[model samples]
Target: MTELLPAAGLTLADEILLAERLNEFVQDREAFSDNTWKQLLSVMRTGSRWASEHGRSFLPMSRADLRDYLLWLQASGRASSTVSTHAALISMLHRNAGLVPPNISPLVFRAVKKINRTAVISGERAGQAIPFRIGDLLRLDAQWSGSGRLQQVRDLAFLHVAYATLLRVSELGRLRVRDISRTADGRIVLDVAWTKTIVMTGGLIKALSDLSSQRLTEWITLSGLIAEPDAFLFGPVHRSNRATVALLNPLSTRALEDIFARAWREAGPGKDARPNKNRYRGWSGHSTRVGAAIDMALKKYSTAQIMQEGTWKKPETVMRYIRHVDAHAGAMVDLMDKYASS
Candidate 1:
């Protein structure tokens, strides 16, 4: 469950080997439910893909091939922030392997800059997209309105908890009934055990609105899971009497993406408005997080406060969520109000 930095004494090959071992550790734990191993595998596969074409016979990689690989990632639709994470993984692999020389030189620095710039330009700086918005939620609720009471309640609960908590899809999917609790002031708070940036310490968030909480309560009561606090909150709702264990697993990443796609289709202008295969699209699963941040920013939440609430470790992380359109609109309103005739 804990993320470890690469060891100092490791070589490039050793780093790769250790990464594989760590992945096995994660798979064996079974305590965690997210796709940590899958994401790490993705990074390793990316390294392999580039290393195949760009690596020298004796060297783990070539500078020119590295540059070209970065360019390929950028053009192939990897986000700037994600690309940077991948770059960090790669750089760590090298540095931990003692690939760099002790004496710094301009040439070495420039080569480092080349790789870093590739990450920056790949949309790595843009960070992850936020979750869905209110408008999008309404559209989704409407789309699945006729399914049934349980399905309706479940859909609303998914959207509400996700947006209200700004939870990653894995956290949302893995949520248990006991994970949520009420504070002294009657405000709802969530005790998120696992997230992208956490190992143990939990964060708190005040109730932004009441509708989400109500939907959550309704889903719990209606789903007959109040007795099974430790069990998955969302799971197969319409299973037959003899359904197997494998048939009723909680939501998967692809399922969540498909849900987002359906909502987006209805929210957008046409069938082509479907949000997929792109990071910074008109909408996606993370749009809820993005929309929540935008909502907070418009309400005058400082970047520092926003970062804390969003559980981001850095201010630049918060900046990445502040989309250009929102920035321009805020600036425009300020200017128009200041210069307008009384």
Candidate 2:
């Protein structure tokens, strides 16, 4: 099941071919859970590049070599989490090929531990995306009125959906017109077909607010996506404001990020304010997700509720998103403030 792919000679097309082969293999055996072959290939390329530079082979990777690769990744200034992801990807590829991953062995596992310890000692924390919370949405809603431009309207709807569903970028991109529906009780439900963590068999459903429902309806009507049930929910509007590029073509990840940034920038009444400008620049695809989770925490929502809303598998992962708020807003801090006042 192992692939002895050329270390240095692998190119972009080769990566694609290998990924496709792996995908076909997955279809037959159902051995791997990940459907994100492109992301896997991207990680594979990093290992391949390193292997090429070091005159080493990546596919039939030795445990010692894998350990060194992790160390090299950290030494080259990659973040601790990022280094772990690199190692994890390699492990995934090995598992996909029915081989035991080197990462599980003490030889390579110790390297990962050391990397984590180093980061902790250096006070290096994993960076969370800048959240676009309820406040940001309200400001945008107040200032970004009117649906004269379809893209403007669509972007607003997109932002609302992102916040309400707490969906990852891939989930957001995969949304189709048919996925949004109104229940008999007038509740808007957005059905998530699959997620990064688990395959929902098209059963995972999320509730969107009436506010979000209205924005979505407006966008659907203006963009005429309702007529095409299978069309991408968030298609790009061309520059002329004439029409979308194509109904079937989904917006690329970069395009989605750009739309978010543009919407964020134009949300402010000033439109030229330094704060808004910086937020637009700093925000990423996960900003709304981080923002929504933090907003829930501030509202005293339980970690369990937040996990269900965001489709997170682990409480620790959810905590990571809202930990900064928790770090400052604990009961101890409130009592300390009360003591100061007394």
Q: Give TM per candidate.
A: 0.68, 0.82
Clashes of 2: 0
209-315 per-residue lDDT for model 2 (tens digits) = 88888888888888777787888888878777754635565788888998777865666333343343223445679988889999999889999999988889999
Q: State the TM-score for model 2.
A: 0.82
Q: Estimate, for each residue in 30-104, the C-alpha lDDT of model 1 and write its tens digit.
A: 543345445656777876866666542112444444555555675677655565566555554444334542213
Off by over 4 Å in 2: 1-35, 185-187, 245-247, 268-281, 329-342
Error of 1 at 215 (Å): 0.6
Model 1 compared with the native: what TM-score?
Answer: 0.68
Q: Would you list the C-alpha lDDT of every candidate in the order shown?
A: 0.60, 0.78
